[model samples]
Target: MINQLLLRFKLLKDDKTLIIVMTLMALGLTLVFSSSMSGNYRPEVMLVDSDNTSESREFINELKLSRLLRYTETDEANAIKNIETGMSIGGLVIDQGFSDMMRNGKEINLSILRSKDSIELIQLRSDVQTTAFKFMSKFKTADMTVDIIKGEGFKVVEDELFEETYALSTYYWRYRNPFNLNSQVMDAQKDWAYNPMIHYLIGFTLFFSTFTIVFVGSDILKEKQQKTWQRKLVSPVSNTVIISSLLIVTFIVGMLQVGIIVLIGNYFLDINWGMNIGLMLIVFAAFVYAFTAIGLVVAGLAKTIEQLGAIVPIILVSSAMLGGTMWPLEIIQSKILLTLANLMPHKWAMQIISQTSAYGLNVSNFITSVLVLIAMGTVYLLIGLKLSKRHVY
Candidate 1:
């Protein structure tokens, strides 16, 4: 076993294979972080006011106070053009007589254009309706108050009541509205931080790390190509010893790559993998073991390096896609696809990583993921060894 381990290391140390391994790791890390940390999503919108009245200007100003959207003022023609050309995500065209309609208690019409449907546009529309409702509520309250005052046989001036109500509502809105709605930042941390990029990084890291398995498994195909396996089969070294040695070397290499990725993510990208570094490593170790086992199964099934090269990518890529390595499982709306993803070991491993890294969860929170990986590795390794014993090559 020891001789086999040393021999495998010597073979892997060859410049070409070593370069491919290092290059893949470096490329994966770069892409993961670069794509993750690039920028945040902020929806842009154009507000076109055909009225240009004080009421319309005030409405636009109220919208400006929203953190939900970035608003720009533009002419109706330009706003339509922008929405159509996708320069702005959406547009709000406040029609003429907007103020007059509000004063007369008539429904105000608006021409809304959206470049694409999204939650941001939906929220923006809600905000617009909310602002209009609030403004109209002041007028409604003043009218009701005047009616009550006149019913008591006291003379009430309509203009004076409206002005007072508007002023009072504006004052309360700006400074002291006891009943006003507010959103506060909760003291407790969110389960997952709003960083899709970090999820992408971790998911892609797990997905790309499987490539190490494929690369290491290719050693079997290499031995066959060079007729080295024939000599080794007749040697005093037992087949079990040879296979164990290969797995050990591959696991070490795989863990090393995973560690480097974690370190780079921490130091370069400033990602927090959680307080329990040791547990995270354990999860990674189990995942790497399972990934290596998958490679062994692929190697056992393939007859040549060409076959390994062709089929291993299809297998790993499909696993990555189905296993939520390309995106989060939460984003996958299809129940069937999600159920299929659950059957993948990669999905479990990714869940472990996500819980630990993104959610700041303790190791104890997802010991099941670790156990699942171990079980999967055991099953795959058993199948791989059985196929390997056939030795069709």
Candidate 2:
């Protein structure tokens, strides 16, 4: 086994196609990683302060502090134009009497111009409204308290009632104080910190795996049709040597793809691969071997190159959907769909990768994933080998 493995390695070293694939994979990975990590999702916010008061200034300053809102102060017309032209997602307009309205305990009209409904924009609007309301409540409470102390009996009206209600609402909303235990408990969920990266990685990995498998598998069929297999069989190379060499070629190709993604993610995207890269590498290597073995099985079973080509796309698309590549499984409310996703190898690999990347997951879970991949590869390879032995024609 050792000699066969060495000879296979040497054959892979001489394969120019393997070297080219590795180089291309490295380049692609670097680019994708850089693009994702560049902080493109945070939208630009235009602030139009027509009031130019202390309140407006404070609001603008608050918006500036939020990492989500990339604030740019501009005139109302320009802000509206920016939003309409898609240069900015939304614009905040603080009206002329905003500060005076709050001071006089009157309703203030704040205008928000948005091209369309978006969750980020809604969240920003909610935060701004809450801050404004809190400021107004504090101002009203202080003013009314002074009036009451001065023996102004008429000032002890519903305005005073409003102050108490506002205080209570703020306290409850801010701290969840006097906790309402009756709220229904929900099932535990995976943490969302790794959602974006994990989903993207799974999609890319599955796509690549399927493509490599089909491409390499079809090549085997082509060789068989051209009698190239027979020519190799007549040489000093045994059947084991040929099979091992082919497996090594696939393994090298798979690693190259992974390396491309990692390099892109690390250098350009500025994403941390994980705390323990060695463990990640080990897991990834095992996954590559599993995919290669599966490809070999497909090739061994397939009578023609066209048959392999037809099957690859089905595997890629199916695996991607089942693996939570299209969307995060957390948002999928269907319990059945979530349960079914567990059947996919891609899903399991993604779960392990996400947990290790975002959180400091223990080594045991990573090792388990590696072992599972190895077992899968072993099973596929054994089946392929058994089928190959009966290929007398």
Candidate 3:
């Protein structure tokens, strides 16, 4: 086994350019794509507060904390003109007497203005609507409390009581929402920070690593070409030993390439892989093993070395693009494409990484993704090993 492993390493050593190119492409494309996709540019959205009341002011303040877009104060005419002229992505408008409308139980007057519907526009609308909903609920609670006081005929200033009660209810709503009972849903929607560098960095790493693992797996065909497999069968070494050794070598070589890319991401690109190092390593391991297993199928399926070289890229890149490697699936409007993406392992891997690293999502949220990756690897490994036994070469 040791000799076989060394022999495999010797073979891989001769292909140093393959390793170097894969590593460089992973990091290089991340920088290029991220820059093209507004790596650090957060779109600015205009805010029109005609009411200029405390409620309206607080609503605008809430918008500033949103990760989706930056909110700035401006007039309705200015907001419309900029959106029309393409200077702004979108705008939110608060009609006159917005607070009175809320307190008086009249229509909730709010409007969203945009050039067209985009992901950012949708998120901005959601943020504006959600904020208004919270204020509406808080006022409802205040109104309920004040009505009860009025019925009791208490000698209290009604306006002053409503103000105090409204202020106190804000703390209650913030500290304890109905969804807090379930820990999973508590902060699920909180602070989904988007960085194109982080997105493309993880994306390209996953994309290019497939080339490394699959090419390494193709060494089985190489061994056949050099008559190494036939020579080994006549020796004391068993077939199991030969296959196991090759698997280990493939895993180690591929991991080193991935590790180098990750290091570049950390030191040079300033990417924080995630908070939990242990889990992140598991993610990397599971990803390699899954595709390494898939490579077995590739090796078994391709009848010639030329076919192996050509078929692997088409399969891998298509999977990557379908899995949201180039651009986010959120922007892809086609329902068929969205549904088909569920079949791609890269989709689950990207989902788990992006959520955990950027949003600080808990492990429980992505356990299913990890499990699916392992299951796919195991199933593919079995099929590949079986199919390789019948190879003509």
Candidate 4:
């Protein structure tokens, strides 16, 4: 095993593999960062407030606090014009006497003008309606109390009593709404703090690491094609040692490549690699083992380097695509595809990295992903070892 490891190291010492790995790391980082930090498409919403009172201003402020919508204060005429021109998706027209009606507990109406209806716009509309309702809850409660008192034949001045109760309630309702959303405009600063690039970087790293298996598998196939494997079989070196050596070398190569990329990503790219570096390393090792075992399986199947070169790319690309390397798995709406994706080691690896890198959570957050990866690797290794013992045709 030690002799094989030394031989593997000497073979990999050439600039070819290093140059390829570095080039890929550089290109992948550039594309991932650029694409992830690309401008967000915020849906424009023009606000037309006929009642420009303090209450109306408060409502507008609430809307501005949401990052979901790019809101602008404009007149009804301009808002209508923008909507017609398709410059804005929608407009919120705060009708005349909106504040007075809301204070007096009258049914309030808001004119929502949209250029075209879509699912996203519908969801935004729903969010706006819900927020408006929550904002008016205090007034609605006060109005109901006043109505109840009047119905009891009390000679209470409705306006004065309502104002007093509204004031008292305002003081009592000091706590923030539990459902209050913390939305920030997508600026460069915030983008740096919560960058999507980190996820993409981790994802692409795992995706590219699968290719190492191809190289390892090709090496095995090359030995068989050159009849070196048969020569080794006739030697005193045992079959178990040869198999163990191949597995160990492949595992080491995968780990070293992955580790190099990760270091480059963290230090050179200035990415926050979460707080749990130890757990992250463990996940990386599990993933490497999984893919390396898969490479052994490919080696067992392929007869030559040409065969490996053809077969490995297909598997790697397909697995990466399904495992959220090519795109986010979240956007894939197919239940069947999603279920199938879970079978890929890349998916579990990505999940573990995503949890640790983004959330800084403990092992509890990603133990399932780690376990899935390790178990998959163990199964693949067992099957691959069994296959590795067979003579290549």
Q: Highest lDDT: which candidate?
A: 3
In angstroms, the error of model 2 at 200 is 1.7
Error of 1 at 247 (Å): 0.8
Model 4, 1-393: lDDT tens per residue?
Answer: 778768766666542574377448745775655564456856788899999987787678767766667789999899999999989888988988989987776777888987666434664687688668756876776788889999999999998888776666555654543346786644323232545666667777787777865576446667777788888889988888877777787777777777777787677777766644566678889988888888888888877677777888898889888988766676567899899999999888877676656555566757888788889989988888887766665
lDDT of 2 by residue, 1-393 (tens): 466566545544444474556445535653575355446556788889889986567556656766656778999889989889989979888889977887777887888888776545765786777667665655566566656655655544655665565566546645774356665424423222443454465456555655664465445556787787777778887888777767776787677667667666656655565545566667778877777877777777777767776876787677667767555565466788888886656666767777776775667888788788788889988987776554424
- The residue-by-residue lDDT of candidate 3 on 1-393, one tens digit each, is 788888888888767888889889988888887776565577889889989998777767766766667888999999999999989889888888887887779878788888875657766778777877787787888889999988998878888998899888877777766445533435333333456588788788889888988988878876676777678777899888887887888788777887787777767876775545567667778888888888888888887788888899899999999998776677678899999898788888888888777777576857888888899889999998897686455
- Per-model TM against the reference: 0.68, 0.58, 0.67, 0.66
**Local distance difference test, candidate 3:** 0.80
Per-model clash counts, in order, read 0, 9, 0, 0
* Candidate 2: worst-modelled 10 consecutive residues by lDDT: 185-194
Question: Who wins the TM-score comparison?
Answer: 1
Tell me the tens digit of each residue's lDDT in model 1 across 187-217.
5433335344456666766777788766786
lDDT-superior candidate, 1 or 2: 1
Task: Give the runs in model 4 whose Cα sits over 4 Å from its true position.
Answer: 13-15, 26-193
- Badly placed stretches (over 4 Å) of model 1 are 15-196, 362-365
Report how far off residue 363 is in candidate 3 (Å). 3.5
Using TM-score as the yardstick, the better of models 1 and 2 is: 1
Roughly what TM-score does model 2 have, to 2 decimal places?
0.58
